[model samples]
Target: MKILITGANGLLGQKLVGLLAEKEVEIIATGKGNSRLPNPDTFTYVTMDICNANEVMETIKTHQPDVIVNTAAMTQVDQCETEKEACWDLNVNAVEHLIKASEANNAFLLHLSTDFIFDGADGPYDEEASANPLSYYGESKLAAEELLQKSNIRWAIARTVLVYGIAHDMSRSNIILWVKNSIEQGKDLKIVDDQWRTPTLAEDLAMGCWLIAEKQAEGVFNISGKDLLTPYDMAMMTCDYFQLDKSYIEKVDGSIFQQTAKRPAKTGFNINKAREILGYEPHSFEEGIKILHEQISAQ
Candidate 1:
């Protein structure tokens, strides 16, 4: 099988590339600029911008991949709020471009969406949950999902939450890494307790996408960690995993931080659909931390 991944430089994109390397399928990894993958020679790497309509069309046409996994997006909520046009271009418009390309190439399009689509009023949402996005980032993602929903192409939406993991050649930090590093440096951190999420490990999310691709699954599926936790909970767990000082971690609420984007108070996914249909299972948050530790230690 031939699979092309967008945003190959990002965390989820890099994880997907690494995961796909072990499989028998052929990979075409595409990013906006020079590939940041540790082993770019392992597979086909292309510098194709998803935001460019002509480029997207030409690249997909040239590759004619059996599956197109789009991991690219302007995911920063505040950034999206500040730069609405760029956000919509990458999130929604680029999706339309991919949809058109997929129609032309007859490829199954697997899109990576966020849990932000739902308001925090009530969470641990199923695939059938009604969406009421509170932020521009969420709105952009939802618009992309709606495009796919209304399109006549083969597509699947893999919605995830608070994805955290290590990636090759990446200086980017997630909650786990941030907590560990901060505690090691003896820096006190204020973490929000009011907000909740099922923080997904990047590898688990990659696996979920792979399952959808392998099955050519249609419609939406929640692919995230089973645990529903807050930032404070995650910090405590991180401390436990690393045997660090918990006194440095302060539990706070959302109002403390002044941010451009409004965060959902509670938004996690219910992965029952994915578990039942795709046989998907994810690691516990502690187990996920252990995995990160192994990677960091090896590095």
Candidate 2:
């Protein structure tokens, strides 16, 4: 099987590329800028920006992949709120382009989505739950999901929550790293206890996407960690794992931090459907931390 991955330079995309490389499938890794992968020669790499309609169409046409895994999007909540047009163009319009190209090639399109699609009034949402996005980022993601639902092509959406993991290039810093760094430096950290999520490991999310592509699954799948935790919970866990002082961590509510985008107080996913259907088993939150620690230490 041949797979074309967009945003290959990103955390999920890079993870997907590395995971698929060990398998029998062919990989076509495409990103917006120059390739930042550890070994660019391992697979076919293309510099195709998904925001460009012509480029997206032409790239898909050229590769003619069996499956197209789209992990690219403008995900910064505040940035999406302030720059609405760019958000829609990448999150919604670019998806339209991929859907069109997928239909033309009759390829399976597996797109990555987010837990932000739901309002925090409810917790642990299933695949069939109603969507009430609170912010522009969530709205744009929901719009893209709507496009796929109405389309005729074979498609699947893997919606995840607060994904955290160390990437190959160390270009991204997640909650684990942030908390670890602050606490290790003896700096007091203020974490919001109100906002809750089923924080996902990036590797687990990548595996979920691979399962969707491998099975040619259709419809939406809630792929995330099973633990429902707040930022303060995660911070304390990091402290315990790294043997740091918990006194340096201050638990606070969401209102303390002023931000442009309004975050949902609680948005966690119920991954029972994925577990039953795809045989998906993700690492526990503690196990995920250990894995990250090992990776960080290795580097």
Candidate 3:
């Protein structure tokens, strides 16, 4: 099978490229620039912007991939709140372009979405729950999902949360890097105790997405980690796993942190649909932290 992955240099995209290498599938990886990911010689690399509909369509037409996994997005929550137009262009408009290309090429689209669509008024949301996004980023993602539903195309939308892992670009911000940096610097960390989520390991999420895509699963699915915890809890687990000083970690309420975007207080998903449909069983937060520590130490 020929597969094309957008945002190939990202945390989830890089891992997906690595995981699919052993599957005997043809992989075509694309990024926004000339940066290439570490892969076998069989993998193809393309540098193009998804926002350019004509370029994206041309690339898809040339590749003629059976599946197109879109991992590209403007993921910064606070930044999206301030730059609404840019956020919509990338998150919503770019998706519309990709959907159009996928339809033209007769390829299945695997779109990566976020769990921030919930308003946090509802805890541990299931697939049947209503989406009441509190931020512009979530609103844009929801709008994109709605567009896909109305579009006449074969697709799967995976709503994941709190993804963190090593990436080609270390400059990218994630929860794991934030905690690791705080511990390495011996600085006091103030983590939000009230903001809850099922923090997913990027590796696990990548595998789940590949499974769903390969199976040609349709509609929306909530694919995230099994364990639910707050940012403070995650920091404490990281400190424990890495043998860092736990005293440096302090708890803070989410309401106190003034931000341009309003974050959901409790955004964990049930993920029962993923478990039953895709047979996906994600690792716990502790296990995820241990694996991350081992990976970092090995590097």
Candidate 4:
């Protein structure tokens, strides 16, 4: 199997590249910048920006990979709200480019989406849940999903939630990392108690994508962590895991902070379909933290 991974420098993309390379597959890792992978020789690296349609098409044509796993996107929620055009270009237009090229190349596309497609009025969303985005980031992702559906190509949407893990030269910090850092520094933290999510481990998300590609599964699937937790709950767990003082953590609602984007009150995922069909099993939030801690310690 030949696989082309976009955003290969990203958290999930890196995980996919690492895991898929171990399988009987030829991996082509593409991203906008230079590769940050441990050893560049592990896989073929191509500098292709998802936002550039010409570049995307050229890369797809050149590789002609069997599967195109697109993980590139403007994922910052507040940034997306402020820079709506950039968000749409990356999340929507870039996906359209991939869809067109994938169809031409006859490559199955396993695209990563977010649980934010829901309005969060009701949580733990399944594959059948209607998309009602509360923020621009969600709107962009939902639009991208629509593009895939409208296309005439074999595609699968793996909707994940609150993906957290260690990565190779990660630009952004996840909730677990942030909480652990704050606790380690003895900094006072005010975590939101209102928002709920089934925070996914990055490795689990990568595995879910690989399963979809390997099984040639189509349509939508909710791929996320099993436990539903609020940010406060995760913070407490991080504190517990690191043996740090939890007294510095304060539980607060969404109203305490003034942000650019409106957050969904609750947007966890119901991943029973993934479990039943793909035989997907995800780590618990605590287990994920433990894994991250181990990885950090080893480094």
- Tell me, by lDDT, which candidate is best: 1
User: In angstroms, how far off is 85's CA in candidate 1?
Assistant: 0.6
Each prediction's TM-score against the native? 0.99, 0.99, 0.96, 0.98
Clashing pairs in 3: none
Clashes of each: 0, 0, 0, 0
State the lDDT of candidate 3 residue by residue for 1-299, as single tens digits: 98999998888888899889879789999989975577448589998799999999999999999999999999999999999999999999999999999999999999999888889987788877899999999999999999999999999999998897777545466676688787899888888889889989888899889888889899899889888899888888777777878888778898778899988889888988889989998888888877876876776
> What lDDT would each prediction earn against the true structure?
0.94, 0.93, 0.87, 0.91
Residue 109 shift from truth in candidate 4, angstroms: 0.9
Off by over 4 Å in 4: none
Q: Candidate 4: which pairs clash?
A: none
lDDT score of residue 125 within candidate 4? 83
lDDT of 2 by residue, 1-299 (tens): 99999999999998999999988999999999999988766789999989888898899889899999999999999999999999999999999999999998899999999989999888889999999999999999999999999999999999999999999989999999998998778888889999999999999999999999999999899999989999999988888899988998888999989999999898999999999999998998999999999999999
Candidate rank order under lDDT: 1, 2, 4, 3
User: Where does candidate 2 have its weakest 10-residue lDDT segment?
Assistant: 34-43
Which 10-residue span in candidate 3 carries the lowest summed lDDT? 168-177
1 or 4, greater by lDDT = 1
